[model samples]
Target: MVLGSAVPRRRLLLVALLAAVVLVVAGGVVATRLVGGPRTDRGATPVLTPGPSTPASPSTTPSPPPPPPGADITGPLNLLLVGVDTRVSVPGWEPHADAVLVLHVPRGLGRAYLFSLPRDLVVDIPAFPKAGYRGGRTKLTHAMSYGSRVPGRPKQPDTAQGYELLRSTVSGYTGLRIDAGAVLTFNGFDRLVDSLGGVDIYVDQRVVSRHRQPDGRHRASAPGGYTGPQMVYEKGRRHLTGWQALDYARQRYIPGGDYSRQRHQQQLIRALARKILDQGLARDPDQVQQVVDALGDTLVYAGGGRRLVEFAYALGGLPADRFVLVGLPGSSVGSGGSYRGEQLTTVGRRFLTELRAGRADAYLTKHPTLKVKT
Candidate 1:
């Protein structure tokens, strides 16, 4: 997650001209399309579909490519990292998200950047038949709700279909092509956390989370009770279990709410990344197997297995300092008046304008290397 956190550092990590670069995370059991089209069904077995493809073998390793050249800026290289929340039983949870970030990894001159698009940013929902929904802007997250049934297609009762709608909706909104996407569920997250053993996060404020066993339903801290919010942990630099760490990332009822919650989410992710690399989690076969088993049936990436492996390889060897993180710049985007509604706020037009104009190159040029503290 810390390696992932470099996404934000791209802002100042490039040399102070950072505002909102993002890393998108969607934690659902869904899969999406390649450059264009609908997502594949979750239950569908992956077949050796013949096409123009590159086969990856252990003997043929990924070569060390040169850094993205700075001058050749064109269209936005946006990556939508969505954390899907498939937690039903809660009311109106369709558009609800676990974590959502959009990363703008530069091809040249500038550093990789990130933008945290608030789930509550209200926007329009394109037309849908059974949805009876047509062009009316709602929270950005809500667009995912209409995924199962495209405007004219039949509802197939497939969650993977919903994820496809989400992928298309986000691409449409930014006018940026989504090069890649990945989806994981709460269980996948917990398994990943456990595989890494745990991650350390600095708890700035005192916030207690309570819940019951069997079903990890989150609650607020209170006095002794049979079925109420259980106090999970105290604030400070501490190690967390899979469930505890997930609760830390999943808590949304903080005093400052989503904005503050988003910031902390990045922080924890960074700490976890640092821990993963430090512990050499990938090198340990036992730990890797454990993580794989935990993530079983829960890990799904768009672009197929080969593409996913390629991405993993590209990112595998990057030094810790090569990372940067940033968040979208702007005022509060409303939550669409519903807890489970999508965030429908637009990014600062000026910031996005600069990004589209390739000003990030100058920003990256001015600040190539910056120091990161532990």
Candidate 2:
């Protein structure tokens, strides 16, 4: 009788364990579907499928090409973060990338580095088939403009085509094969900031708005038109709202001009990253969902939802301080009475070499001024 009772008890325990396993498996499925599921029109941003692939022979040696200038050598991931300013008033105006940043997340995923490319830097742009402008050397910002319109064709904005051309041009210039990319419109950026409950950043100096006039109109706006309220940021640490943060970053009339604006932009990135991690956004499912929704509205990635979620998860292990921001070393050059473009200095090339070798920290040690902090 004892042996029979023991056998029945064992069977009952086995059934209980199977039920638990099924529940666990079901839960996992639900979680993945909620967070990393396939793309949809409303939730999934349109993914840019990579161009044609070239298959290699089994006997071919599998070695990566030499790291390009400003390329990351430590890992496979190189992402381009573009901030585009779309002009609605101009009928045929294509959006231009106001800011371009290369985010290098190494294979180990311990830390990430961001390198900013100046918009005014002169570079060679290939002839775009759609735009009639037989492209030659021009400002880096013009690549997007040239790519947005088809030459001799009706005025239609092709942002996707523009992105591809810009990607190609950037890849050629940086010597890094851009594996993936994201474009964030200015409007989206503002909304993202607001969603995060604002970000805290340290303003190095008191920033007076050069774009705003005393009469409460933007310098660029029409005489009678309203450009919203003007903002003046005091020096030191401050919590900024979405519009305030955007205004702070858009200040080009400051002492350093565009370079200063670039630095401020980098600071904004750091502040946002730090804020997200500090607020436990990653740990909270509800918060994560909210952020994902916000991103869906503003952010477009080449890898779609899955890739974006995967990348976010990969960075979960990293602390806020692991993000490092560095500026490409360069100076302004010009001819005659007009202002010319900027060129990367010798130090910049050396900096790229160190970056490719995965020793940016060491490079920063040598040139402390290039290091940016929020």
Candidate 3:
């Protein structure tokens, strides 16, 4: 048993080392999404975040090369990327939430940073359309519930509106401005995952799957019955594909619960990012196109390709060691609420206040090496 356990750990260590290897080849495709949207012919909206003006990382390293001659001087930018699990069979896909992440890319930081926020974080969904009807303050995920039912071309509580409200609320709470955004449905994520040839993750425990009845509006499950198994893996690193990987990155019901799941998500993102940068995708156009094709109908970008490409190139210019990831401060707080009496948690306002001041580096500087685990 001891030898068996050690074997997995050794394997995981090896996988981690190859991490940088995958990053270079895959960097081209993933880097593009860091700031850019999909092809214009696809009818995606252009992202509106200010282009990097002056490099903001004057402290960690010299500012990134100045933007071209007339380059604008935008400061640090934040993005709230959401992953929804809505399939054709699951119509009335009520919650439309699978994962929620906050990506922070500071001017001149070069690399993209990601933070996964637990959906269970009980907080006020500010500007929620029902603010007048209900106190508006409720579980964060409910924001999608409210918008999906709103009638009209301009969905009342649509993702964009909810995102803005969320951005404002998170900013108000975290002191950051969410500049741009994107939404990928469950199908989109699956394809993207498959296209990237899956992501590697470390599983520390056993998990079992339970069957969930599809909403009937979305795609139907296989004849064998579409029950999702709870995954159980020994502590070690392994490559995961499609649904398996998704479930691994999304299991919030584990012993550690949402916090563990959030950490898992962050690690997945970082792992994916690193894999891309190390894979040298910039030199492989076919591979880059394949990854893009996988995104297909699932991706909804908020901006143009040129600007996005430029940003990706900029990120590729940065060294990996300088990249950092952090979460919203604070932990699970109050308890006893609606929805199964779920407990709520909120990050400290003061910490966020400092973050908004563009001094996250200050807090990070103090705690130089904070390793977050799933």
Best by TM-score: 2
Q: Highest lDDT, which number? A: 2
List model 3 lDDT by residue over 1-374, tens digit each.
12224334433222222221122212111221222233453534332234656655756765444343112424366666666555435534443445667666667645445566556556565554533324366666665455444454323334544444455555554456665555544433444555567778666565433322122122336776444433354468777665566556656666676666666667666666665556443333223223333444433334333333233334444455445556544355454652521332333343344456666667556655433543
Each candidate: what lDDT?
A: 0.47, 0.60, 0.47
Ordered from best to worst TM-score, the candidate numbers read 2, 3, 1
Q: Per-residue lDDT for 49 in model 1?
A: 27
C-alpha displacement of 190 in model 2, angstroms? Answer: 3.7
Off by over 4 Å in 2: 1-75, 130-133, 151-154, 211-220, 223-230, 279-300, 304-306
Q: Model 1, which residues run further than 4 Å from truth? A: 1-77, 89-95, 108-111, 128-133, 150-157, 210-229, 232-234, 277-301, 304-306, 329-347, 361-374
- Runs of candidate 3 with Cα error greater than 4 angstroms are 1-74, 87-91, 128-135, 152-164, 188-191, 204-230, 280-300, 303-306, 328-350, 365-370
lDDT of 2 by residue, 17-47 (tens): 1111111111000011121112344544332
Q: Write candidate 1's Cα lDDT for 1-374 as tens digits.
A: 22233333322121110000111322211232222233343334332223455667889986554332211233234666566666555554453445666656555313445556677766555665545556567666666666554444443333455555566666666666676554435544555555545566677666656353424665544566345546655667777666766776666677666665666666665565444334322222222222222333544434432223223323333344444555443354334663544342243444555566667545544434311122
lDDT winner between candidates 2 and 3: 2
